[model samples]
Target: MRHSLRFKVALVFSALTIVLLVAQALGVKTFAEAQEEKLITALIRDDIANVMQGYRANPALLPPFDARLNGYVSAADQPLAALPGSIRNLSEGTHEIVLDDREIHVAVVPFEARRLYRVYNFSVYEKQFRHVIDMLMAGTGIFALLTIWLAYGLSGLLVRQVAGLARQVKALRLGGSTPINPGKYDEVELVGLVEAFNDYHRRMADMIEREKEFTCNVSHELRTPLTTIKTSCELLEQDAAQGTKSRARIQQIERAADNMRELVNALLLLAREESTQNVEPVRLARMIETALAPFADRLANKGVETVIDMDRNVHVAANRSALAIVLSNLADNASRHTDRGHLRFSYADGWLRIEDTGSGISAHALPHVFDRFYQASPEQTAGHGVGIGLAIVKKICDRYGWPVELESEPGRGTRVSLRLPAAGPGSASPDALSAVS
Candidate 1:
């Protein structure tokens, strides 16, 4: 219905044209043929009978375009292009002759020795078709107009249900739960499809509302414990500075508590990202730097060197905070898993690769490496809080339509690569980065 009026009109006209034109052609042919057959039958039995008998008695040669003995009749405008001349030149009993490259059907019933009656039909159908053609040409335009009008009216009536469905779709787009109330007593299949679409929209609205409520309550409850832990750790840091050589142990405890708080924050951030209500552009390289800032001490403690290689202004489509969580998880996984080996971080060919020199993954565990609760090999599990790191990484890859591949051997080391998918030339999307946490 929203489509242009011209298109609908043109479609209707085209269908009408086919039907009307075919009927016109067939009617012209049938009428013209019947008229020719009637004339031929009459000539053979009635009008030319006496002329033929008179000519048959006088046996003579048939001449070209002979109208007298050969019953050569035609319309007034153009006489039949038959043989021309009289039939008095040569002796003839029964003669066969060609006229305008066509064999004329003829018979000579003898009435005398010198004169023979002859009858011939030289393509009578062709001469009659000319009149039919003229009539059809004169009337086709008027009939075509009538056809379009009648067809358009019927087409409009037939398409009324389609127009109603279009309006229902428009309403659903503007208002998620709007009903598609197109009438459907005769259009059973179309009605079923519209009903299914409305049902899907209703389910989606319910899901989004439920997720919003769950996210708010979970985030609120999580914040309380996080605040308590941060306060107690700050108090402990102040106490250790007062004159306790236990500064090192207290500092270690503070760091661990801070890490736990960051973990809780990451979880909440992940939930918000899944809501997909808000998104913004973020540069992946900068997020990597921010996440690296917190792990400086861990890198030093393990005697593992960290290298960052990337374009200074590389950009990716994402939420800054969500992407930060993603990098934090990946870096933490690399660092914690490596005992005293080098960790390499680099971005190349629209991909980020992280490799750690530590205990290479065991063959049996590689298959489930990214499972939600899978643990790393013993060397990296010192205090691995939860087993969701790689799982989160995998989810992020799926969301962005990226691919994450891991390569490892028993003693060589482990390498994780995140490569861009074949989307049009662009950086990652928000939902993809959000899946990281």
Candidate 2:
């Protein structure tokens, strides 16, 4: 279904060549036929003129006769009964008639009291002409075939450099510093294109190196403080005389630290082009609970109900940390948007789905919901967290080869689904519905 440039070029050349060659052959055939007719007419006219001059000078002279040419004299009032039946009724100045399968040219001229008929038989010449035309047609056909072959070869030569360039581009790597050698190309335009591509490749390599360094530095600086905060919270939680409120605050701090750590890890994972994490079987129910832990108070404060509709024994084969990050982001988005009603999490047939009855995304914003840093309308921007949560989920899903889909409608609700690589042996049943309010 896909056509390459070489094939298109060759087809165009072949078509044009055939059209021009056919046109030239037809023109030559037509011109040759016209010239032959003119020569025959001139010879007949000359013979008639000589016979008329001789008869005028001496009334007793007879018209000439030959194998190809003949002259007949008949009185203007007399019927041409002695002449051939095919040319007897002709009254024109010059006419062509066929007699017994032979072609004849007749020129009728009026003299003092008689009509002169100059009849020339050119059937042999006509046969020869037909043979020449047949030969010409055969030559044209052979030349057309040769032209098609030549056109294909020339087109291949024309596209050879471009094909080589494409191969070189495909072989290029992202982190490579070596450039395509411009000297390999002969055309100035091709050399310029090669130079431009080389420049772009170098710029991209430098940009990627800078981004890698930045992510490394930021990761180190942020994790150090996050670790200190988590350790201090653990130390404080161990105090014997700490009040209930104080203990709750310490736990909140610990949870926040944990969330920040997961966010950092997720961002780092997204920054790299490849993942090195080992795949393992992750308990689906436990991972969902962990992702929703931080949003428990928020959902409760909003008077929103929570429903988990998946079998407890269900597990998925994936990178644990990556799955955690994806689930956390989905939970965060659902919790942030839902003010009332219920948020549901369910898994079936290797698909994990999160549905929320909240202020759903509008039709205009739905398409761009997964774009990095894409904010919704002004009213929805509050507490949306710069719109990278879904972007992170999308990136992680792509990295793990999981298919993710989102559906939303304004004033209705939103649903996000992710198809995991593999699911454990289990099924959803009525007993699996666990409601928490």
Candidate 3:
């Protein structure tokens, strides 16, 4: 049922050869039979004419009987009474008769004074015909075998060419080689396939390089304005009136600016593909507080409760800027979705879980939650985002070999989990860094 291209080609080729050979055999047999009949008819007619002339010349004399030619003469009292029924009508043409197991050709000649029957044995011709048929059958068998061998060899060569192309395509996919030369193959479609794949690879590489350059440039240019805003907020917080709530608001603005600076740094490192392994032990609680700082006012304005369940002494080995970006993105996503119920961040069993009570993802959209620019529902995400937050988190985690998982149910909630590696000698203690409190 799963036949290969080569097998199908060979089968069709061999079948056509067989049909031609069979036709040739039938034509040869028919021609031989026709020519043999003509030769026998001529010989019988000439023999009948000679016998009639001889008997007429000498009525008392009978022509000599021979093996190849035989005849019988009836006496006056029994005039050809014992003659075969096939020649009883006394016709003047060649006719065939069978006697015992031998076939005979009879030429009946009626003269004025006497009647003559000329017989010629035709069994020898039949034997020759059988011999020729046997030879034709043997020749056809040889040619059929030759046709099979030739078809198989040609098909094998074609299959080898296709397989070589497939191997080259595989090498290209694994980033093991450059484009293969399509000119080596004579098939037009295969040449097109090679050329098309090579073109696509070149275009993809160029596009990614351009995107990386843009990200690096943008992150670098935006840092100056972000720094100025941080400095302005800090100044505003210090010189504000003592009893006013504007002081606390300015403090919040400073924390948000700090978070933005960390995010820009992380993005720059990502564009350069730098390893963020400058491992430092930061207190889990303090890290969470700093990450949630920018979203604090939003949560309060939305009346969304915040629940933090993490140990103060639980420290992890990570780069501060990169970890802050990852945490901020996750926490910001939770805050944006949840309105009334609490947004929870819990750390246990080396896993960090962020759960939000909001319109959860549909079953159809859940699998593609981390795909770039994928939205669960157009109506839900219309004014929310361009769907890049989770995609960014997934990309950062993949770069560091971290595992991330998501669970969601429609109309219920969504929960995201990040699995971190356990602390080791490479990690520092929480006491080494000042807490954010």
lDDT of 2 at 238: 91
* CA displacement after TM-score superposition, residue 153 of candidate 1 (Å): 6.3
Winner on TM-score between 2 and 3 is: 2
lDDT values, one for every candidate: 0.65, 0.81, 0.77
Q: Residue by residue across 174-243, what tens digits does model 1's lDDT show?
A: 8646566636536887778877877887887788789879878876787677677767767877773555
Best by TM-score: 2
Candidate 2's C-alpha runs over 4 A off are: 53-89, 99-102, 111-114, 174-176, 239-243, 275-279, 371-377, 380-384, 398-401, 423-437
Cα RMSD to the true fold for all candidates: 8.6, 6.0, 10.0
Q: Which tens-of-lDDT digit does each residue in 1-437 have in candidate 3?
A: 79888898899999999999989998998998888889887776676666666767876677433222233442222222234554556566676767666666666665553446655666776888889899998999999999999998899897877878878878877775577888888898888887888898788778878988898689868888888888887777678364478877777777777877888877776767776655666666778888888888889999988888887667776667777888988888888877778888888898988888977878988899899988778675588789898898888888766689999998788999988765675556555544333
- The TM-score obtained by model 3 is 0.51
RMSD of 3: 10.0
TM-score of each: 0.58, 0.81, 0.51
Full ranking by lDDT: 2, 3, 1
Best by lDDT: 2
* C-alpha RMSD of candidate 2: 6.0
